[model samples]
Target: MKITVLGTGEGGRLHAAKLSELGHEVVVGTRDPATTLARTEPDMMGNPPMSEWLAAHPGIALLSFGAAAAAADRLVISGIDGASAVNALSGIKEQLTGKVLVDYGIPFNYGVSGPHPWPTPWGSMPTFAVLDSDSLGEQIQRALPNTHVVKAFCTQEQATVVSPGDFNGGDHTMPISGNDPEAKAAVVDLLKSYGWTDILDLGPLVSARGQEMYSHLHSAIGFALGGDRRFGLKVVR
Candidate 1:
């Protein structure tokens, strides 16, 4: 499988490396490959630069967004940040047509202060830009009408997501929502390969609203767990 992870962030790098380890041809997408390779300092989240990561992991190609999307066999994991996702993806619409786009981003608007802000070690927690009525999944699906967008992985950290067995014998639940059943199934298959045993089909892109909105609670849980513990939320049915 030729997979494209469309971002240079920590999450994107994790997916790219893991997918490569799983024997898939992985390509990471960025706005400009040269600029990404030129970075010397860590990213905002303190992850090592892309060039540093690429040097450590060989054979994984890094390309421009359009080229990366076009190179994918069928799947694309979008790790682009929420604020600029729509615009960045919209620019490469043609390359993504008819492909399954797995969106795991929360639509967080850090610039706008929430009505009641929750402060943390970093700063005040960011508020959702699209809440209650709309979601980033729906927005991406609309932006690329021909693309199949399935929402997954927003509820947990990327490391935990790619390797669930590291926590609680992989007993946690992974919730996915999308309008297209086939696309959702493809994403579920990917999750299974990553060792997920309890994947919940939350039904339709609208369900992404709840999946994404859970980020606030997720943050609270992290803080309660001492801010660095890796834990999973299980749906105890």
Candidate 2:
């Protein structure tokens, strides 16, 4: 499989490494190729740069966003900050047409300010940048009208997304939702290859609202877990 994993952060590099290990033709997409290649320091999250991941994977490729999208058979949209998810993909919209674009992004900002609390009147409600009225997945679909985007792997940590089976025999559920059946199936196959055994199809792309919004609860859990992200939220029924 020729796969383009977008984003230069840990998430993108992680998927690129894993997909490359699976014998797929994987290339990482970033804003600036030269800058990304010159990066000797870890990313903002302290994860080692893409160069390190590439060193371990030897043959994996890296390219600019547009070129990577153009060369790939499928796309794994990773490394997106929720607040800017739409802008991230909008640039490559034309190249993504008819491709299974598996998106793993949450629409919330992550930084030193930490999570954004709810608005004053609804202070109790979970915080988010895109919610209720719209979602990251829907926004991408709207912007890239010709692309088949499937939302998956947003609920799990980078560790969990790539290494789920390592946890207690991998009895967990990852939510996947999108409007296109073929696109969704392609993502499902990819997840299954990565050891995701239990997947829940939450219906149309609109269902992405709940899946993406779950990031609020997910953030709380990650914080509560003393920042350990090795575990996943499994449906126990």
Candidate 3:
């Protein structure tokens, strides 16, 4: 299976490495390959530059967004930054046509200043740009009507999503939602391959509202857990 992870962030790097370890042909996409490689400073999250990660993980191709999307067999994990994802992905709609896009982005409005602000170690807590009535998944689906959009991985940390078995023997639940049943099934299959045993079908892309909106609570939980702990939420039924 050929896969393309569309970002150079930590999340994208994790997925690319894991996918390659799983013996899949993986390519990473970014706005510009040269600019990404030229960066000497670490990312905002304090992770090393893309070039360092790429050097450590060999055989993974790096390409522009359009070329990466074009290279995927049928599926693409969209790790694009939430704020710019819609615009960046919309620019390559033709290349993404007829593909399953597993979107893990949260529509975070970092510039927002409200009356009551929740400040974290980094900065003020980001408010959802699209919330309650709309979500990033719906926006992407609408923008690329030809693509099958699946909402997943936003509700949990990227590390947890990739390796759920590390916590409680993979007992926690992974929730997925999308309009296309077949696309959702494909994502579920991938999750199973990653060792997920309890996956909940949240149903319809609109349900992504709850999933993406949970980002704040997810952060809050992280803070409560001492910031460095990786945890999972299990749906005990």
The model with the greatest lDDT is: 1
Lowest summed lDDT window (length 10), candidate 3: 110-119
Cα-lDDT of candidate 3:
0.92
Expressed as tens digits, the lDDT of each residue in 43-69 for candidate 3 is 988999888888899999999999999
Ranking by TM-score: 1, 3, 2
RMSD, every candidate, angstroms: 0.8, 3.9, 0.9
lDDT of 2 at 140: 87
lDDT for position 155 in model 2: 85
Candidate lDDT values, in order: 0.94, 0.79, 0.92
**Estimated TM-score for each candidate:** 0.98, 0.89, 0.98
Q: Which residue pairs clash within candidate 1?
A: none
By lDDT: ranked, best first:
1, 3, 2
**TM-score comparison, 1 vs 2, better candidate:** 1
- What's the residue-level lDDT of 209 in candidate 3? 96
